[model samples]
Target: MGLLEYFRLAVRALKSNKMRTVLTMLGISIGVAVTILVVAIGEGATKSVADQVNGLGTNLLTVHQGPRQMKLTAATRNAPTQTQSTLTLDDAQMAATMFPDTIAAVAPQVRGNIQVRLNASNAQSTVLGTTPQYMIVNNVTMRSGRFFTMLEAQGNLKVCVIGNTTAGNLTGNPNADLTGQTISVNRDDYLIIGMLTPKGTGTGGPDPDDMVMMPVTTAMQRVLGAKYISDFSISCISPTMMVMAQQQVTALLRQRHHLMPPFPQNDDFVVNNQTDLLARSQNVTKTMTMLLTAVAVISLVVGGIGIMNVMLMSVKERTREIGIRKAIGARSRDILMQFLIEASIISVLGGIEGVILGVVSAVLLASFGGWNTIINPMALVLAVAASASVGIFFGIHPAQKAAAMNPIEALRYE
Candidate 1:
């Protein structure tokens, strides 16, 4: 018989057991849907991180006082603490001045938490001490007013820039013109010179829009009362110069810190480039996605088993029909093809339904759950192909068993 005849026969055979066919199809569909959903969510999360990092400029490199380490113990309760950072504002200045050709800008930063009060209202927020170069190196833009001038930074003026979230809390309106208004921090009132444009949360970090910014000199002398800097951000002259900039900064800091040959596993300071960090983060996400996808694919295996069980039962129930067809000169290959075709039809149909369900689920998650989800076309194609393959692989044994049965024995079966 022709291929179309085989499909027609397969459909008729499946129609005879409507409920079982539906259940089998449902199983395959769920597997495909889950696999697609997991992969899409994973891809979305990676993309979100990449975008956040890129927003800070791909040519950026961050130099921290030291490599941060997580300490876990019965006493510390798994809290992470940093080793005393030897990096200071002087180190920041030296790096900028020493690598003028490779580095475009350097913004040293110190951070502290403080309670800010504006008249009767009060809010707790992070205060960052940074140079005017911070706005340029970190790609920060002011929504209103202007960034603190270098002269103001040098003079240690009592001035600050409020982020969007802090502005709303202190002034009761995010869009309020707080420029030139005063907010009390550490019992010292600071004039709000500018407001920063809203920047969303960082990758696995605090919201960037929920802090206050001030000149490094003012924050050290007037607010935080500290001498050491937490970190510094450096912008390279170009993307191609990021590696050279990183090398220069590392060598400069290592020599300045007086580290001898054979640098210890834990360096006094570290320099991180944005592109390398992005790649490392993406690799982690990709591994997680693969593991989750493997779990989802197990469901497909289960669905395939269901198809096999049903097909075996089908062969027994249709023994008399099979015997009559064999009696009429039907060949073993013909019977095998018919059964295989039936299984493929079921799985392929289920796969189509699954693709639709997965897309809708991804959209719903992004819209309502506030999650990032990106549906890849390759994922859809792979899911469908996997479903079809599962059907064929599991259906082969049952099809072969039926085809190998003796015609005389099958004909006489009840």
Candidate 2:
């Protein structure tokens, strides 16, 4: 018989057991849908990491305190609490002064979480105390008013700038001009000098727009009560100067800290350029994506097994029909083709439905769930193709079993 004739017979057989056909297709449908959604979520997370890193600028470098044990250990069981930082505000100033040609700007910061209040409104938020150059180094922009003067930072004045989200939380309007007003940070009133433009949510850290910025002197001495600053935000004169700037700053920090050379392994500080940060962040996301994709593949395998089980049962139930067909003019190849076509139809239909479900789910997640989801057209095509391939691969054994039946025995058995 022709291929179309075979397809018609296959459809007729499947239609005769509509409930079984749908139940069999359910595994493949769920598998394909989950595969597509997982991939989209993974892709979205990777992209989010890239955007956050790139937004910080390629010429930027961050200096952080090296790994410190947070948990009690044999080595640290009797040691004094190592809350002190090796980095100091003077170190940041020296890096810029000593390397005028390579280093353009330096912004030293003292950071912590604190309670903020504006009259009756109160919320917990991040507070960053830094120099006036923070705006230049971090590409900060003000929507209203102006950044505090260098004099204010040096004098440790109680003046601050608020981000869009912070303003909204305290004042009930994100776009409200809080400049020239006073807000209480840790119950100390500080004059608001400026309101920053919206920066949106951050990845793997606190929301940038949900924090407040002040002079580093005020933060260390007053707000955070921190004796040492947290980190430095340094900007090179240009992208080309990033490498030289990193080296010069590193040498300066090592000399000033009086660090002995077992080289970098014994060092108490780490300097990371934007490239290094980007690569590290993307690597984490990539690893997570790979793991999730493996789960998706396993689901597809499970679905394929389901198809095999159903096909096997269908072959048993239609034994007499197969026998009668073979007793007439039907060939073994025709019987094989008919069973394969039925399995293919079930998988193909399920795949199409899965694609629809996945796309809609991705969109809903992006909208209501506030997640980033990118549905690549290629992913859809591959998912459908994979389901079809699974159906055929699992259908092969059952098809062969049906084709190999002895007509006389099959007819006489029942």
Candidate 3:
């Protein structure tokens, strides 16, 4: 039979058993839909994480005091933490002014407990003390006003920059219009020089925008009441310089801290290159996405099995029909084509329904979970192709069984 005739015959055969065809298609649809949604969600998660890491500027290395614990081998990888609080603000300043090859700029961070208040609104968030260069090092930009000045940082002026969340809460969620307003930190009013452009969620507990920024000297002396730094960042010049910068920063910090050679025992500092850290994060996300996709594939496999069962039963019930076709001048190839076309039609139809369901599911997930789920056109096309492949794989044995039917015995069946 020609292609047109085979399609017509397949359509008729499926239409006659509409309920069974619909049930089998439903199974395939559900499977495909689940797979598409899972993959889309995983993609969104990966994108969110990538964007968050990118917000930290590219090719950065940091040196800080290590965790005061022995459980983590990571703790020992950098210079060990000093139980005596050995990192001083002066050490960070020296490194900032001296290290210029691989390190572009450095900023020492000091933190202080402060109550941030604007008008009647109040929320307590840690205030950060760092230099004006911190804005560029951190890839930070102001949503309204600009970051603090170098002079301001050097003079230990009382100006502050804050994130969106902190601004909102202090403004009572009416308007985070804090650019010109003074935010009282530690019962001391500081001019809000600039409000940072909103940087969204992070694993660092809250968005960076939520915190307040002030001169490092002011935070250390006035707020923390100590002349020490909590941590520091060495923004590398390029991705290529990341490793060199890491090594250079390690040596520099060690030298500044007056640590002897091979000082593995409780040395006073830590150095981190964010390139390797970001790569590990990407790998983890990729692995999770693949794992979710693999789980979803099991459903597709089960749907294919369902298609096989349906087709096998179809061949058994239509034994006389197959025999009649064979007895006439119809070739086994024709019989095979008829069954194959029917199975493919079932799968393709299911695929269309699956695409609709998947998109809807992704939309709902994005809405409720604040995830950026996007099932791209390519993914939808691939799902349709996968469904068709599933049909062919499952329909093979049944099509063969029908094609091999014995005409004489089939005609004598009651």
Q: Every model's Cα RMSD, please?
A: 3.9, 3.0, 4.0
lDDT for each candidate structure: 0.87, 0.88, 0.80
Cα-based lDDT at residue 219, candidate 3: 85
- In angstroms, the error of model 3 at 376 is 3.8
* TM of each candidate vs. truth: 0.92, 0.92, 0.87
lDDT of candidate 3 over 175-256, digit per residue (tens): 4667888878778889988878776666445556568888998887767787678888778778888887777666766777
Better of 2 and 3 by lDDT: 2
What is residue 220's positional error in candidate 2, in angstroms? 3.0
Q: For residues 247-324, could you state the per-residue lDDT of candidate 2 as single tens digits? A: 998899889987666667656788999989889988988898899889888988898899999999999988998999
Which scores greater on lDDT, model 1 or model 3? 1
Name the lDDT of candidate 3: 0.80
lDDT of 1 at 406: 90
Stretches of candidate 2 above 4 Å error? 68-81, 115-123, 184-189
Q: Residue 167 of model 3: what lDDT?
A: 76
